[model samples]
Target chain A: MSAKPIPGTPVFTGAYAMRGYALNKMCYSLNAAANRAAFLADEDGYCAQYGLTPPQRAAIAARNVAQLIEAGGNVYYLAKFAGIFGLNVQDLGAQQTGVSVDEFKAKLKAHAIHNDAVKAGRLANV
Target chain B: MSNIIGSVATSHIPAIGNAIHKGLQKDEYWQPFFDGFPPARAWLHAAKPDVAVVVYNDHGLNFFLDKMPTFAVGAAPVYTSEDEGWGIPTVPPVRGAPELSWAIIEQAVADEFDVTTCQEMLVDHACTVPLQLMWPEGWEGIRIVPIAINTVQHPLPSAKRCLAFGQSIGRAIRAFAQTLNVVVISTGGLSHQLEGERAGFLNPEFDDLCLNALINKPELLTRYSAHEIVELAGSQGAEILNWIVGRGILGGAAREVVRNYHIPISNTAAALQVLEPA
Candidate 1:
């Protein structure tokens, strides 16, 4: 089956996998507390050790989700990068949506309330 | 011969594990979610399946992005949960049913599904969280066969493929000669995306639609492409593909004994349902 691309979304395929191999490996290393601490102590040296490309290193330094995705960093592993900075998944989401963290959180709160109301038959679909 | 006595479909959110670890079960934020699990606990006690075929995805634990397997089955003698960045509380090592795991692997290969067989694999929260929630006493006596799917990176197995894989698992378990009562536990997703600009997106409508279809018309879920799942449920919402595997094990029909859905569980909606063979 021919792949149908989602508009405005970077789908992580084998091609992306190949492209982000080094970048992802670095992110995967964050699974260990020691590795996370090491990366935090020396981000550039760690990125250099992973052999990340200039673009990938730049994206990592910038904490740009779009750039990371474009550079082949899967969000699951990118989460480790976000965690290193004490950022949660929602923070990454906020970055991706170009919204402030508080705004993104408010949006999440609103969505949950709307969903609860929908479940209770108090509101129509949102 | 062994038979699938029951099936469970639930979200394996890591925060759920954290909640249990921190004794937040009675906390106002988690009381309702915790309340929903008693029926599951009751069902587990009543069913008392000898083995649990847990279907979950590895969250950068056992397999990294370097060698992501589309489908991998654990054939080890014991499965342990390792440190996943954050230091999670220690849980007892889960006993593995190698005999059953190998049987499924053999059948899956013969059935043309190239499954990666793992003799040693460390499980992550995706596998452990559900086990903690469903079998809080620890999986000491009951054995488990862990089936890991690729939901982390894209090009994930389609919902149709996951169902087919589950069907293959059903056949393998049924074909085994041992008189074992088995439960198929499919963990992950009911709609909350965890990545991209779409993170924190929760679609209770889509979650309900998926749950209703799972009970009445499971095949309806197959029509949704992974992208469509992300569109409706958010990017991480694609984890619902794991639940499709459980539905596949139940074949076309099963009795839904308990169902619970909640939103905003750390940027994801959570759903849990217990199904018994009809």
Candidate 2:
């Protein structure tokens, strides 16, 4: 609600919701198995059917989370797009973090170990 | 009069469902996780509530981004599980307590909560995963009243509001004249972010704080803003809102009967807690 936003995170506010409506709707369509196949067969045509903006279409083509976010794509909906490419949420997270999937996974494992050590009082600050 | 018996909160990770479906409960990788659920299973069997009011959020399943409902309740007689894009082995349809569902809807609306009532709804991992973990025997004779909350997109309901919604649901259940016991189960989150540059983030410290607060100091948790939750826990950690709802259903205070927290369950920290009215 404030002019000072939450820094880096793209808050999916009313404005973002409105801007990404078409893009989100397209992503939503991937819930159905048939819809996923259809999109894979004709990506551009599917985007067009959803009335996606050029930027959104470009973002879809690029498979970039940042671009999709800028084009008003919510991460939850964007997950469907990622799934179509055999990328799970973690894969998408890796892309968003500018790291390779293996690196991202390793970080997760390290974080868990670090947290466990901290809980056991072996480590102080994590 | 119908009574609110108890509540259970657990992380409904999709991987948990897959592991269970693949019969990997005894496997080394999943053995530790499965070890935590025996107490929960025993408790469920002992309590034997006639109906369970399950609070879970759909992940692009029933309601897509086209029209995401902040709060949706299923009033259908039977609810089936969705395929969730990839082919998840289909489970038997869970029977729904439509009469109780309608009663909750009517009372919730009167309580000034805008709730979407669905005649037909599909349950996804959010609902099925937890069900699989909590009640592995399956949902053949068991009855469930599914309440879907929104934690997918931002601008989600505040922790305080979600708690209030749970309280309202408790009241509605009490108002019903059914001579049956009820259990409230809320699924999702300990701490894991699925999006942004801060992906794969986990905070056991914050999660412990949350589990403690839910048992002894739930009022303390309501102060946490969505931004603070994301900053401390992770984006998907917002699903803790569902847990808050579970706590609120028990009203003032409840004793934590069971608590389990395990980390790195597919890029997220998974937790399970059961509370009984004190």
Candidate 3:
């Protein structure tokens, strides 16, 4: 059942959950508008309130999905944190890949051609 | 006696909720994906089901990492939607069927499934979006019993495990004393990742294989472990586990009524498939 890991795809494992619990809790709290506003009003205080680790705090400060992930933040939760600044999944993807928002979107849109191939039954079997 | 009429599976991407809210179904970017629902909708109209058993994952809305349940069932009289901190439009509260929920929970527990039962549950886009798409006028038309799977955490239930769980749920539904016609609806995945450098990743071939195997040879998919599925299908793409469970619930012979696949729906290979038992 073991398989080589996919590069750049960090599966949110137990270790990550254990490490990112605080960071994720903070992000999960943003589901409430009040919590989101509270975090916005005092970013540093919010992190402290959640007891974010130094690395987790740095990742949040960096606004880097990769770093946040490395610090144990799952994207589902991290997405709430991203929402604070109007960053969607594309923006997060672009940030993680070091590409512009347009470029990231283009990357996703380009899959349409591949989908057409599959629809046409021209795609090779897996 | 209660019976499963069929199963409908689709990608429950958050953007879809926004699109439906903004009346963007005809927008060029969304048309193709939105168009795929008509056939499935038509079939649903013809085969009216009284209740929907929705299988989906909670994206940090109902459960947090601290008390993450591998399998959870909604036992509330009603379920509400949350914005999930992203300002996505929330749908009206969907009615929940506690009797069916308790039946499935009792059966699952008796069968050693160890599923968590929630008296008060908040469903996320995964559960809400599909219901909205299926019943555009309103979700109030159908009562729902949501089965939330743990797809966010790494130690997710194996594909085989989800299949078995679905089968257990099917038995519970069929054995219910009430004469309820239920439809099993599941949301998530064809193949698109939204994490790390592989964000927006799509695998058309793998997606095609999954779509085909889901109908003909679902067991072929159980060979891939959860980690392996993440490697091949992307972290979020593993949401196909929901599909696997739906297919298992269908259990015996079934035919694919309709299927729609489109790429790049908010970082997902959006797919809609309807299957009816033979």
Candidate 4:
């Protein structure tokens, strides 16, 4: 709980939990296959049923991760929403980072340099 | 008296479930991650645990913002995996050791942990993926007792508290009248963010510190607040709280039997470690 928050990594604290409760609850319903179909059948209706705020509904309609988070949507719950769109974490990462999916993927793949170095025995067991 | 055999900590990524469903254990992309398991499997098999005390955080599956429990213990006769929105095939129901589960619940509460006790809990990938990896033959042989920690919603249990809670669980296991062997498995994270502009953020250095600290100096990890953990390990990487509990359940000093760290497994820096008491 610092004045300067961890950049870009929004912690889903109690405030955010209370703020996003309705929105997250809708997403949580997506855990059941029937609920996923119900949402897809009528996205606006589902949002209304969940009593989502205008911003949360808008974020859901736009399929924007940043806007959703700004509207108090937790990433784990948002992931269920994202899954309805056939998007995985990599796709969400690409969308949020404003990069091509491949570029976002490359960024993740790039971290393997350390793995390579470690494998080469250049780094001791971590 | 019941025994604390060891602990296994691994990534419970949903992608791994899909890979398992597709028979991709040896696929080029998954080989490295899958390769990390055999040794752990060998050690775990040799340990012959009758019950596995799984410590993992539910990822919006069973518990939601409606009533999130910082720590929930499963006291059900069986724990089932349901659809997690990804359509990843659900693993078979995990047999539950209600007797052991209730014992841990009593002990954890006595130790002032105040954990939620669920008589019927639907476990998600956090429980299934790692359990599937450990018991690919199916969950018929060994029973399980799940402990779900809230790593999703913040005001998460601090590193120190989770480690302490885990030690209390260790005591519960040790005091049980059964002479059963037990293995504690904690799932998720090294470092890799899955949300926001820092979606692909990673910290191999922080992971290196943790992987070593789990074996050498877990108190070094307790010094951090949850926010500090998110800053160092990505938001999702805060799942290491699950790992700290796993380490603590080892009761004290333990020997690292095997360890593996790999990156980019669906926006995660996956790490697995199998340890036994020194």
Candidate 5:
């Protein structure tokens, strides 16, 4: 590891929002057809079947989609939020699995898994 | 009877929750909206769940941008919310269900779900602070399963894919065959951008539409192309998939329990919902 510090001055203003082609492709291609129809039908039947009025269903539909869009898709944001739950992402896979960085990286690379920060660091370490 | 229950949908702007706990809600633009949650208090108290399987996104707390997992489940016995410089005041640590956690982890893995088994985790700002203000009372006798989704960056799982993940988890939980009644919680979203000049925003129409789909028609919500959702909601708003997974785990057709929507909570729409079993 190396360190470069400038006294009383900021050195770099780097910003990174987690994004990648693999993730975008996953989002673009993943589809749930039956699930969508089932959900729509359930909302409709609520009036006759469950006793919910149209306005109520409308409100619910509006709210449900809003909720899904707001919190459902982003991965980098999710990891950041999970941190609030006390699960810190230690870059080293040593927290619980007892796998050394080097060992974990080798295993992950051999398996062709490359999205892990720990594995990436370990590759550098190796 | 294997019945369908209610669902919760809320915006999880990390900064807003922290602001409320620190008493910054009033000092900032979040004051009026933060005050909106009082009415929903009664609903939360009445439908208090014994175990809350809180589904949320990890904001680089546990996993980093270097390498991220699509979905991770916490099978730990107990968890402590980590303080990410946005101090949480006098909140008790969250309790866990070691038994259920282990069982589900084993089941999911056996079912080929590449589950991450965490023995211990410092519950950070993302999970606890919002949960604290959201549920209060710390929910006694109620255990918690902290599940993480990959939502921060691009190239993440689609909303439909997350629902599939949710269904898998629901199957695993039902397989537990225990006497304990569980409450599945999906928290996050409704809209409010997180980056660039458009960061602090609230699309009420969009937010309402989302909540409706989550409570009355989750299946419909799931089919939304990720791009469409991002178009309707902000890009950062995609974290709602965590909540969708919870709804998916609970079998999609959730009854609405409570709904509260507020905007400008420090650049967040700050919506909250508590779904019940129908």
Candidate 6:
């Protein structure tokens, strides 16, 4: 599904598609130690087999499955959990969320020109 | 049926405070965003939860890539905000319930939930920072038990599994046999576009619906698969595990106190909610 927008915000066009609430809930009870271990061992593979993308897969591979399942419940938790495993979730996105750090600084530099009067001895804290 | 005293749903969108502090929220373009939270704060003040079990996703602050605990519980007495790169100014450390946390941990383990126990932690902005804003400092003698999730990573638990964990937590909390009033707090979102070219995006309509499902009808959300939430909320949205924790622990039905949402706070849309036993 395409992403929706807030009343005034424009639709953003980019490679990364807008997200939707489209997950299937899984039963999380473990009947045996073997089952738990198997789930842990194949957690990454399970997500991959089920169609989790690469960045998502990387996030799941990084954490202790037992702790993650208990604390975080799904993909959102896994994505954050991936951070613990050292995968940069932000960088995983193909689209850019905002201006780069350098870009931000350059914008500030350009904006600085508009307020030159305040920069002089005219404004106290400028 | 166990008495679910209260529950809360909050957004741990790390950038909210940053936007507020920088006067970005006050900017004309951002004014609508700041306006969304006043009602949220008012609602929380009325609910007045005694102790809160906050479930949220950590941003690689406490646990690292070397060894990450999928579901780690905080049994510490005090949880201080950590210096995650650009650190915040000095804020008093939040208090925690080591006893209750340990009790829940022990019970969850016995109940067959393998829970990780954390002693010392630098509670990142994703958790403690947001709590500071939503709930009052001294009211109802707030004590916390931090539970961190691995949401940003893949191979994470599915949505159904998360709701199941929340159910288990509800059972565990019910068996506590303590007289203290407990509130389950879940932090994270509906559909927020964080990161990438789609940053600064917000869907007020989706946010409203998510709050509705969480408060009056969580079952509505069950239809959504884990992948669906990620696609809608953002990849980082895996942090919504906190919501599942609330669903599990709160049990039965709830009275939602707050549902405030806003967007364009440093490339992330943010929302906050509070729930009470119906």
DockQ, Cα level, model 6: 0.05
lDDT by residue (B77-111, candidate 2, tens digit) is 99998767644555778899999999999999999
The CA lDDT of each predicted structure is: 0.82, 0.82, 0.89, 0.88, 0.54, 0.55
lDDT per residue, candidate 5, A13-43, as tens digits? 1122321222222222212233224434564
For candidate 5 chain A, the 10 contiguous residues with the lowest summed lDDT are A6-15
Error of 1 at B238 (Å): 1.3
Report each candidate's C-alpha RMSD, comma-separated, in the order given.
2.6, 2.7, 1.5, 1.7, 21.9, 13.9
Q: What stretches of model 1 exceed 4 Å from their correct place?
A: A1-8, A113-126, B86-90
* Candidate 6: segments with Cα more than 4 A from true spot: A1-126, B1-4, B19-47, B136-140, B193-206
Per-residue lDDT of B1-278 in model 1, one digit per residue for the tens? 89888888888888788899899999987886778899888988888789999998998889997687999999999999887664555577999999999999999999899999999999889988989998887677799999998877777888889889888888999999798999988998877765555567677777877777777577888998877777777777788888888778767578788877666677777778888877
The TM-score obtained by chain A of candidate 1 when compared with the true chain A: 0.84
Candidate number of the best DockQ: 3
Please provide, for model 5 over B1-278, each residue's C-alpha lDDT reduced to its tens digit, 9 standing for 90 to 100. Answer: 12223445555555655565666756644654566566555665565556667788765445544456677788787776543322234357778987777766776777677866677665555576556665665555567888888666545577888887777777767777565666676767766444322333345566666666665577767777655565556655676788788877887445665666654443345667766756
Please give fnat for model 6.
0.07
Model 2 stretches with alpha carbons more than 4 Å out:
A114-126
Candidate 4 stretches greater than 4 Å from native? A1-3, A116-126
Report how large a share of the reference interface contacts model 3 reproduces.
0.75
Q: Regarding DockQ, does 2 or 6 come out ahead?
A: 2
The order by descending DockQ is: 3, 4, 1, 2, 6, 5
Clashing pairs in 2: none
lDDT of 1 by residue, A5-124 (tens): 555556677788999999989988887889998888998898899999999999988889889988988887887777777777777778888889888877877756545543343332
Best-to-worst ranking by TM-score: 3, 4, 1, 2, 6, 5
lDDT of 3 by residue, A30-94 (tens): 99999999988999998999999999999999898899999999998888989889989989899
TM-score of chain B of each: 0.97, 0.97, 0.98, 0.98, 0.85, 0.84
How displaced is residue A19 in candidate 5, in Å?
11
TM-score of 2: 0.92
